[model samples]
Target: MAERKHDRKFVRTFFTTPTAVEGEEDSAKMLRGAVGLRGMKAPDVWVPDNEDATAPSMRDEGAENIVEVVAENGADFPGEIHPRVVWHRDSPATRYQGFKHMLQISDPERGAIEHIDGFVIPEVGDIDDWKKADEFITIVENEHGLEEGSIAMSVIIESGQAELAMGQLREEMGKPTNNLERLFLLVDGEVDYTKDMRAITPTGALPPWPELRHNTSRGASAAGLIAVDGPYDDIRDVEGYHERMTDNQAKGMLGIWSLTPGQVVEANQSPLPPENGSWLLDVGGRKVELESEDGVEIYDGNRLSLEETGDGYVLRVGGDGRELDEDELREELLDMTEYVPSMDDIVDSMEEFEAAKEAGRGAIAITQSATLRIDGVEIDVNKDRMWDEATYQAAMTPITLFQDVYRNRPDQHEELAEMYSEDVVERAMDVGA
Candidate 1:
C-alpha cells in the first residue's frame, strides 16, 4: 500500500460534509461549503436521513429496517461507504450499484474530494452490526480495489447501548494496534441517547448529557482513540458555542464537529497561556522586584483608579492620592524599575532576548511538580502550572552554566563573582544544581 498521511496527521477538526447525496446538485453545493471552511482538516462522506432515527412504528425495529432507511438515503457511503454497501447488497432496499457509481463518477470533480481523510459509522448499536460494517470495508477494498486501509475508521458513540459496549465493540472489530493508528471516537447522538436512557430536561439543557460526553472522552482516551467532540446544536449562540468547545478541548478532545464555518476557529483554538510581564510593585515602602506569576496582580483592586481628564484618562494611585503623568511612569528615574525578566541573570537582556528567538519556548523544557496551598486548599500545580507560569528567564539559567560553561560572558557582564558561594557556583556550574 502507498504511504498515507493519516498515520502522521490524522483529522483534527472534523467537518461532516453536508448529506449531499439526496440530490447530486444539493450534495455538491453543501459539500463545497463544508470542505471550503477554513481549518477543516477533513470531512466524512455522509450517509444521511435515518442516521439513528428511531422508527415511529409501535413495534420492534431491527438492523434490517435500519438497512432500509440507510439504503433509501444511501447515495455515497463516504462516511463508511464500503461497510454500508456490503450491509445492503443482498437486502434489495437500495440501488447499491448506483451508490457505487455516484462515488466513482462524482469523486473526481468534487474540488476537495481527494482530501477525504476517513470513514464514519453512526448509530453503531451492537457488536454484530459493527462487524458487518467492518466486512463491508474489506469487500470494498477487495472488489473495487480501493486503497486498503488508506482512510481511518471512526464511529459515533451516540446510542446509549453503544456507550456501554464501546470497549467490547472495538475488541470484536479486531482493530489491531497498527490499525489503531488512524482511529476516532466522535462523541455524538446525545438526542437519541437521552431518549434511550429516558432522560428528560424541560429546560432543554444537557442535564445528564455532560456525563455522556465525559464517558465518551474517557472511553476514547482509555482505548487510545482520538476523541472528536460532536457538533453544537445551536450555531447562533456564539458565546455558548465557544464555551462548549473550550470545555471539550479541556477534556482532551481532539476536535469538534463543525456545522458552520464560524465554529471552526473556536474548535481549533487553544487557550492563550497566561500573560506575565514585569511591573514595579511597591512592598513595605521599598522597591521589591516581583514577577507576574507570583500571585501578584496589578489589575483590579484598591491599587489604582482611573479618571477621565478632559482629553485623556489619568491614573491616580489609590489611598496615597498621588498621581503620575505618563512620562514619569515610562521613566526609570523614580523608585520605578522596568520589569526585569527572571532570566536577566542568565545573560544580558539582549542575549536573553535573542535566546528566546533561538530556542522555541516549549523546547529546553523542564518538568517540575509542586503543590501549593491556595486559600486553604492544597492544589498540585505540577508540570501544567509550571508550563503556564514559566518565564523565559527561569528556563535559560541552567543551559549556559552546564555546557562546560561554553557561553562566554557577555560584553556588558556584571561582576557577580561575589554573589555565589563556592557550592552555589559548583551547583550552578553543573557540580550539583
Candidate 2:
C-alpha cells in the first residue's frame, strides 16, 4: 500500500461532539468543552459535529462556533481535529451547506484553518459521490492557497453504494482530477446503514453487522486507510463496550466512534498489549482463563477434576473420568493448555529472536509451561510456540502502537509509564528503529 496523506499513525478513538448544544445559554458550550479536553480524556481525533448532533435551525451558528472554538483551543489540544459537515448523496442543498462550511473553516483569514486537520463527509454514496466530496476539498485547498493535499477527507460508510465503492477505491486513486489520495479514515455508520438496508430487529435496536465491519476493515487495509467502528449508544455499559473493542481489534479495526470523553479513555487504551501474560484451558471447547495467586497458576473451575484411585489417579474432564498415568496426564494437559504472552514476555522473546537472527538462525521454538494443583494432585502443562521473521514482524504491531501513542499523546505518558515502567517504555520507544 502507498503511504497515506496524514501523519496520524494511531486513531484509536474518533470523538464527535455537537458544535451546538440546545438548552444552553452558550450555544457552543459542548464544542468548547470538547476542544478544551486534555490528558486521557482527549480523543485521538476530535470531531466538532455539525450534522446529526446539531439541530437544523442552529447548524449555521454551530459552524461559526466550530471555527471560533477550534481556533482558540486547537493549539493546546493533542489530537487531530476533523469537523463533520452535513452532506447526503441525494441532497444538493445539504451538500452545498457542507461545502460552505468547509470553505468557511478552511479560509486562512478565519484563523481556524491552520488548526483544522480535515473534514468528514457523511452519508456519501457511490464513487462519484466520494469524488464530489474530494473535489470540494480540493477546491477549498486551492481557493485558500493551501497545499494541494494538505486537507484530508474522511467518509462515513452509511449507504450500500458507499460500501460497494470502498472496493473500487484502489483503482479510482490513479485518476488525476480529484485528490482521492487525501482519504484518511473509513468510518462505519451502522445506524444509517441499517436504515438503508431496511433491516429489522425484534428489540428495535441496531443489529450488529459484523460483516459490514469486516468489509470496512478489509477495504481500509486494501486502500491504506484507517477503519473505525460505529458508535456504541449505551455509554454506561462499559463491559459491553470493551467487548466490542475486543471484537473489532481482532478484525484489525482499532478505532471506534466515541460519544463521550469517558469512552475515549477506554478506546484509547483497548488496542495496546496486556501488561501481564495469562494461561487458558480448553473446557468443553470453550477457552477458560486460569487465575493467578501469588505467582502460582490456579484453576478452581469444575470443568476438570482429579479423583483418587488404587492405580494412580483418575482425571475427570467435563464429568468424564478415566484412570491415567503421569505421562497421559501430561499429554492431556498439554493439549488443552494455551499460553497468552504479556508485553514483557513478547519483548523478551523478540529480543531473543533478534539475537538469534544475528547468529543467522531463521526460526526458533519457545516453551511456556505452568503447574496447576487440583484436588491434591499436581500436573504440569506446557505448550511450544514458534517464532520466525514473520512472527517477529507481526509481534511488533503492539510495540509500534505503543510508540505511536507515546509520540502523539504526551498527556498519556504518565499512565503508560505506570503500566510498563519507565525502562520498558524507553526500550519500546527504541524498538523496531
Candidates' TM-scores? 0.50, 0.96
By summed lDDT, the worst window of 10 consecutive residues in model 2 runs over 1-10
Q: Which digits, one per residue and each the tens of the lDDT, describe model 1 over residues 1-433?
A: 2122232222234444333344243333443333232212223223222232222231122223223333433433223221211113123233243234224422333322233444566655655554544444445444544565554556776576677766563454334423433444445666656666777788966553677778777766666665666667688888887777667656655456655555544443322111123444443355443333445323333444444345433544545444444444323123433342222233333243445455655433333333322122222322312221245454443333222222221210122223333343333444112
Residue 382, candidate 1: Cα error in Å is 16
Alpha-carbon lDDT of model 2: 0.89
Task: Flag clash pairs in model 2.
Answer: none
Error of 2 at 252 (Å): 0.9
State the displacement of the C-alpha of residue 159, model 2, in Å, after optimal TM-score superposition.
1.0
The residue-by-residue lDDT of candidate 2 on 254-315, one tens digit each, is 99999999999899888988888988878789888888766567778888888667767788
Candidate 2 TM-score, C-alpha based: 0.96
